[model samples]
Target: MSLAVALALGTALALPAVAFADADDSDNLMRKKRFGQNTGTVTTNSNTGGHSQESGSKATTETAVISDGAITPFITADGAAAMQAVADKYAAVVAQGGWPKVPSGKLKKGSTGKGPAALNKRLFMEGYLRAEATEGEYAQVFTSATEDALRRFQRNHGLSVTGVIDGPTLGALNVPADRRLATIKANIPRLAEYSKDIGNRYIVVNIPAQQIEAVNDGKVYSLHNAIVGRPSRPTPVVMTPLTVIRFNPYWNAPASIVEKDIVPRMTSSGASKVMRDMNMKIFNGVGGPEIDPDSVNWRRAVVDNYHFRQEPGGSNAMATAKIEFNSPFGIYLHDTPEPHLFHTGSRFYSSGCVRVDKVAILIDWILQGQDGINSSRIAELAETKERLDKPVTNSPQLRVAYLTSWPTRDGVAAFRSDVYQLDGTGFVVGQPLPVGETQGGKRYVLKPIPRSLEAVDADEAVGFASIFRRSSDRIDASERLPGASSKSTDSLVSLKDPKAKLKAQGRDTGKKKSKAASNGKTRAWTGNRERSASEVMSMPDADGTTAKKPGSKKVASKKAKSGDKSKTAKAKADEKAKTTKSTKVVKKDKTEVAAKKPDAKAVTDKKKALTDATKTASADSKSATQKSNTAKAAKPADCKAGADGKLPAGCKPAAAAKKPPAKPEKTAATPAKTASSTN
Candidate 1:
């Protein structure tokens, strides 16, 4: 018995996961999700056996409890009708003043609030709770039932299903009822467009949700996660028929990619390197003449309208198969080598095509009715890397749409992030600048400081002239005015006048002193004034000019006797002579400065020219390179930090944000149709 049980368990582990279909259509709440829900166990298979089918609401089992994980195709007539009803209910809720804001804090199992008797009505009022909570007042107490309800709410909003309250949950729960109603109504038109001409068996690639749905007979047959085009290079919405399946396909570069991407890269990385890395060959036209990559100018190629064809292999962009369709947008479903991006919450990274995660399994499902094409044969062909094409005889009608809000079949509305800012909902996913462009910045050259000599020389000369003038005045007052009884000095005693000589003869000096004293008499003086040694030294020095002192005071008793001239007479002569010499020296400096003026001017002009050249070079570098400012503390509101305190991806500088969007990729002309269709 033990051996038998071990064998059965091993078989269960090895066997591929098969879809467990529900008996009743309404109990669609699934315990697992296969279409990239943030939570829940995802089971994927490459087998051709069956697919998972569960989509409707957050709760649906017999117990009518909220079941967290479920996969549902988003766009359909039934979903549209269901959402219209959802819109009405929301309008009524808005009219009645909407739901209460959930208390902001940690709320999980075992948490407590007011008792259950008063009716814990927080999430219930927001259409989250189907039945009454058994816990505290107004469902304020965190319990298992409350946790499940919270997870369902989070999942429906395209958020990670962490049972406790988070930044995103509070934001969604508190959205005004009127706004929510408006968002629903705004999305109704797109849903209505999807509803028309959609047959019972069809395929949907909802761009906002980033998930692909294969529906048959009004039910979800399988769901696969998908990566769609970015907002800048948005995937076009279209309705077409899945025509042919091309395996081991060659990827022809679109005109937009050639001009916007490959050409620009070739400018920096050389044409040969890019061609070798991408495994591409340049052709004169689609199937015209072959040209060597080294001989072709990549930029000129874009103008000449040359084509780029990537060979088929592991490095090929289309890994396994290509689902051909009829459209002008040049967008179709294909497989990718970088499958890890399928798990990303925002899978808006492609140029224009839809990249399916489990593409082989989907192909196997679509090719079932065709002869000689099966899972085993697909593996065989992929191993050999052989090119092949099979027509899809009963191919399902395909649609690519952008629906941010849709109601599941059971009336519980599910929402997706408005990645493209469609639905008129103000919310959008951002694309930040590359880290190398902002964080790991380029270095800029520093310009040198300028120094001019002309201004400095002129200022020094003027300063020296002023000093000499002040010194001369002080010396003159001390020598020439000391003998006067009032403020007046001798009429001929001018320090600035070269004509004033201090020589005085015997009788003339006496007559002059007596006459000047009599005429200048206003204030009274007692005795002959004398100069102290300290006063002589305290006067400001002229550096290169004369400093004169008063004559030694004569003895009062030994007044001027017979021909011995008074000592003051001799001192006056020396001062007048020195002042004249200093004035002459100043005039000589003025002449010398004037002679050097041209040289100083030339030095200043050269300095200015060097500075201007340096500034011009700095400006050129700024234009050529994308430099970063590491000192910025605040960010633009469009690229603000998130919960992790880091900038969201796709945030560029304000100058970069104004640039026009990426060019749309051109579609290849539809390949000629064929017969002998496959599954």
Candidate 2:
């Protein structure tokens, strides 16, 4: 009995171990099906699946996967809940009658128009105006209540809150309820996907809305306006930890900007003018000797081959601070010199980087736990105008996303325009992963890399000048003001050799000769001939020594001959007219004789023939009337006895007459006597 109990205990322990092995195998199969093969190496966890540690390293790996699933690192639980509430509210609004559209015009205080009534109705539906405040049939007057309601609506929709129904306000109000609902539904999944595992502290940048929020402990710590990337150079969606914040950092212009923007400006505006105005310096290469602006060939030196660095100052492109983050696309957040852009309704004007408003506040928040860095230290650095680097000990995670609809913590849902169209139905998927090494030790396959500026064709490297110069060159010289110099002509002259200069002068003389000929000037030719006395008498003498050009004398004589011939032709035409008049008179006389009256005997014969015809017609009418009466009298009665239905004697109906067959025509009779004589 003891031996049997020991075997049973051992079998039970083995069964649990076998079951665990089966579960792990199943998990591996599911992962493979979802994400394909495990081509990448996975770090093992020393604690739980949520956390891991590398061998001999204190750095812990924060697993992206949360309790539910792997998600974008930026979304928070409170944000997702807020979005759900907004979606539900908009759905209910759709169930009821949707919001009314305000008319397409401006509405200010004291204005009495139909647009004001519509605006009031919209505000009431959106819960910005009280029902009692909108009393009356028309509500056409734009009262104080209406202005206050408009202000609230604008604030909620991320507008300027001007308290007037301006163009932007009217546009936001006119968006249909159905579209708003659809936008909410489309973005709800995105919120759920990205907001799943966001920790207690992080930053959220919404590209479509151009806003950023720093959240801590389920609440917004600070909010600021942002200027994101333009459409052509869109800001990429990424989630990475920001590691450093630099004060008064230098701006290294990217290669693309140098090739496309700076090069053209330098070429047109002159290198010295551009560098001085922009506070930029040209270097031979990275960390190489700084070159004098005048020494470089502004016209021929390729901008892509050189490096441009802007000095750190208040006037620099990146105004004062830069927040460093690891991204393969080389993107980051920084401050800008143009702070007025933050007040605009739409602020997408950067070249793939984000420009944050109130960047000092953000830096202070990011460096909360760092050594020797705080708001006071930042202020001191700004006053002194000194460049300083501050490393963030507790680096916060940043998620840049394109979300058009979001909900506030108070359960108020707001919808923004889909500027980037990233709500799944957009042309692009999400922000594309960067091409090179990513933050999580993963590499993304991207399209063929863009060719370097040096690799591009020489003609193409000139950019806009190569495309537009030819068209500008075609403008006529006469259109320019008199005495104005032509830059292109001057450049051409400066480049020409002395031999070419002489040839150009000869060409100009030939052009003048053609112009004289076109003006009808006469040319003189010389020959070995003696001048006759008559020729000399007819021609005009020049100073009594030289005669007039022979060409001019010949032209004058030809004109005289032509005049005499014209006179002879006119005389012949007059003589022909006289002959034609005489012939017309003779023809008229013959026509009068032909048009005389008809003969008298012919008229008398016509009258006699008419009388005979009248008498014959009267006799024929009398005979036809007598014959019709006799036929009517001889008609047979019905073949029936009166009221007895018996046949009458000798009253048979007459039979219809049959037509006789036609006879053959007779042939000409043969002349037998003539035939006998011929024989």
lDDT of 2 by residue, 297-342 (tens): 4434556656677777636665667887655456678877666556
Q: Would you list the C-alpha lDDT of every candidate in the order shown?
A: 0.53, 0.55
Each model's Cα RMSD = 45.2, 32.8
Worst 10 residues of 1 by lDDT: 670-679
TM-score of model 1 vs. true structure: 0.53
The runs of at least 3 residues in candidate 2 whose Cα sits more than 4 Å from the true structure, single-residue gaps closed, are 1-75, 92-97, 102-151, 162-167, 289-304, 343-345, 421-679
Model 1 lDDT, residue 430, Cα: 16
Query: lDDT score, residue 253, model 2?
Result: 70
Clashes of each: 17, 1
